[model samples]
Target: MSEQELIYLLALQKVPNIGDISAKKLLRTLGSAEAIFKSTKKELKLIEGFGDLKINSIHDSSYMEEAEQELLFIEKENIKVRYFEDRNYPDYLKHCIDAPILLFQNGNIDLAHKKIISIVGTRKVTTHGVAFCEQLIEELAPLNPVIVSGFAYGVDICAHKAAMTHGLQTIGCLAHGLDQIYPKAHAKYESEVMDHGGFMTDFWSGSHFDRKNFLKRNRIIAGLSEATIVIESAEKGGSLVTADIANSYNREVFAVPGRNTDQLSKGCNNLIKTQQARLLTSVADLVYVLNWDIQDQKKQQTQLFVELSTEEQFVFDTLKKLGKSEVDVLALQCKLPTFKLNPILLALELKGVVRPLPGKQFEVI
Candidate 1:
């Protein structure tokens, strides 16, 4: 956008009580932020949500000063800003009613033609939760989904790390401004994260750090993806809050189930029992429920020429014939011992030629 348009937008954003929804309404009515400022009081009053106070705030000169100062910061830091209505803004997030009118981003984020999933859970994650988070990302790497999470401790960081480890793009949704990283201990991961994906936030520069910011940040995590996964959470936590937001947005939510007695499992268990989320055990549950067709002809065409050993070819041919079948059934048909078949299956899986289903079933991707 032009410098004048950005200045007007920033000034409009500083207006009290003019949130994203109201701002959009005004934009639709007045045609541009510059027009909104120049329009008479009668024009502003015509918009449904613009009350006397809100309309008056738009005329305040101080807001322009604040916007100018913020503009300086944006230029100085070389920050990238996204207008909500712009084509470059996240597509899913654009549908959210409360999505920010403006968002700040840093790093190499590319969401084009990609599957995005948000993984969140309790900050005090259990060993099982960590393992599941890592394994889930590893398994999903081939499809090249963008992993998203708050850059907090435990589960969020674990999800980001796992995604990064597997060479997948991972977005860190920050609760505060991009001017600094929270949980200062995680500073070490900043450069690596920027190289792969990046951090995003609506919070402005110099905004005070507060615990409450995280609750507000949760909406971005929920809005950006087609689905949200809660690895583990206590009865009440930010991760559960994200799941709730995802449900509200009509996006799919999946929770990893645990024993009823486990403390961190309560949130996930309740979500399942209440039917707020689907139960997730492995990548298969997600693949099946989301109906993600990894067997796209384009994806398959890229791998059709992969070299395979005679044994591996036999296993692949068997899997292709049956579509998907239990390992024992495949072994019986191929006349190979199950022990020998297992290694062949593992090698195929590593080569991204096959994927395991919930039982002992396997399918060619």
Candidate 2:
């Protein structure tokens, strides 16, 4: 967009009470931000849901000056602005009704046809949580999925680091503007993150740093990915909010189960109990639930040489004989308990001798 067009868009974004949904309505009706501002109050009032207060806010001249200043910051910092309708904007996020009309991004980030997943949890993540987060990313690295997370303490940073270690792209969704990092201590990782993926936010430079902004930011994290995973969260926290937002967006939500008594596990357990999220144990669960096609040539070649154990062979034979069978039926037919049969099935899946179907059924590949 041209400088003048960007100025008008930034001004429209600054108008109070005109959120993304409302702004989109105005843009669609008026055709452009410049036209919206140029139109008379009478013209603006005709749009559905436009009230006196909203019209007055849109006509406010002060936001134009603020937009001009923000424009200068964008130019000076070489930041990339992603209009909601632009092709470069995040595909998953564009479907969200409340997604930002403008997203300010920095670094060499790419989202085209990427397998993106957001991992979020409590800031005070436990050692076990950290280990699981790392292991999860490491295992998923082979798929080359983009790892997205809030650039906060604990699990967020851990996810970013793990993704980087695995040579996968990672994105940090910030609550504040790109001009500054929230936790100053994270300054050291900023350059590395920028190099690997980048930082993204809707807030302009010098925007007020409010705690409420974090909750609002959760939507972006949830919106940008095909799925959102909560490794660990307290009974109440922002990660659960992200999970809820993901669900609202009709995206998959996964929660790693924990011991009932553990404080961090309460939130995940509650999510599972309420059927708000799928119970996640390993990468296999995510792959199966998402039905990701693993057609890589290398994996295919390895599958050809895979050697299944006696238990796995028995399970595979039983499943093949039945053509397709749910976990319970196969367990009974194989004379193996469900618990014992599950691992064997997983092993067969990894060996590429079996594929998981919907409703926990499995069939030979």
Candidate 3:
């Protein structure tokens, strides 16, 4: 993390054709970014996957100059830089193969031992989407999960605001550099976001604004969280791309279902129909699937007074009698179809009368 090491890392990051995977390979083989640059072409060629073009790009002097300039910006702005190998780097993101070699951060962001989830959707989020996003966060507030989003219009901002309203940390994963904010209008929320959580990005100051940047940034959104939730999206949108990336990372993905005719719901519906995402009707589905421990005393007390429907009560009583039983087994015992039993179990979970165990088993709380 010294100035020289950071400069070398920044230069390595700037090298063309050498992405996070390649850079990691070089760093692991050579032991340091400085060594990678200091080594001869013959030495570099010894590494598998290092071709002539990538080697030539590594030797380009301009990258070093650019790195130096970027370093100056970092110092001037007091930006915190996290090397991928450092403990301060995002834990979930570090597991991703293509995660950035460096992450630039602003504000009092903390991710240690925290339950993090990313909420993303279309920029033109519907009113229903807004209500669902807000209500979801409010219901989840007791568990104190961190909310992460793109900081754009609609669902992203709605998630951030709702998180803040509930006194929870929220992170905005920006497509641009910390030096500027896209959309410009969101400037008002920047300070509040910083105070509550902060802005995170791999891009440097003065980086060109490109449409492709949003796609690149989506990986960060999906990588940083254990789960990614798409509240609303069209047939083609960035949120769908994020869901794909999350699935690729072996992370959980959830999509809110909508009516068949709703344009914004098409993407989510497709995701569910294709079994690419879990069909999420309420926060209870998420809580059950992720098996998040509900340890809040107030929440526990409230659950005691919760009234369950006739079906939910039956399912709860069956689960208690059967002890921990898989969803399939519980369905048989309850004489309910799997589909019908799933919702009843979700309702029981929402009432806090039952808890989901690993391998789709459930037990009374």
Compare the candidates by TM-score and give the number of the best one.
Answer: 1
Task: Report every candidate's CA lDDT.
Answer: 0.89, 0.90, 0.90
What is the alpha-carbon lDDT for the whole of candidate 2?
Answer: 0.90
**Per-residue CA lDDT of candidate 1, range 268-354, in tens?**
999999999999877767876888876663254345567778988988998999999998999999998875676567557756788
Show pairs that collide, candidate 1.
none
| Model 2 regions more than 4 Å off | 297-365
Error of 2 at 363 (Å): 12
The TM-scores, one per candidate, come to 0.87, 0.85, 0.84
lDDT of 3 by residue, 1-365 (tens): 78999999999999999999999999999999999999999999999999899999999999999999999999998899999999999999999999999999998899998999999999999999998898788777767799999999989999999999999999999998999987788999999999999999999898788989999999999999999999989999999999999999999999999998999999999999999999987776887789877655335645437876687788888888998999999989989878557656655665567777889899988
RMSD of each: 4.5, 4.5, 5.5
Model 3 scores a C-alpha lDDT of 0.90
Worst ten in a row by lDDT for model 3: 295-304
Distance from true location, Cα of 358 in model 2, Å:
13
Clashes of 1: 0
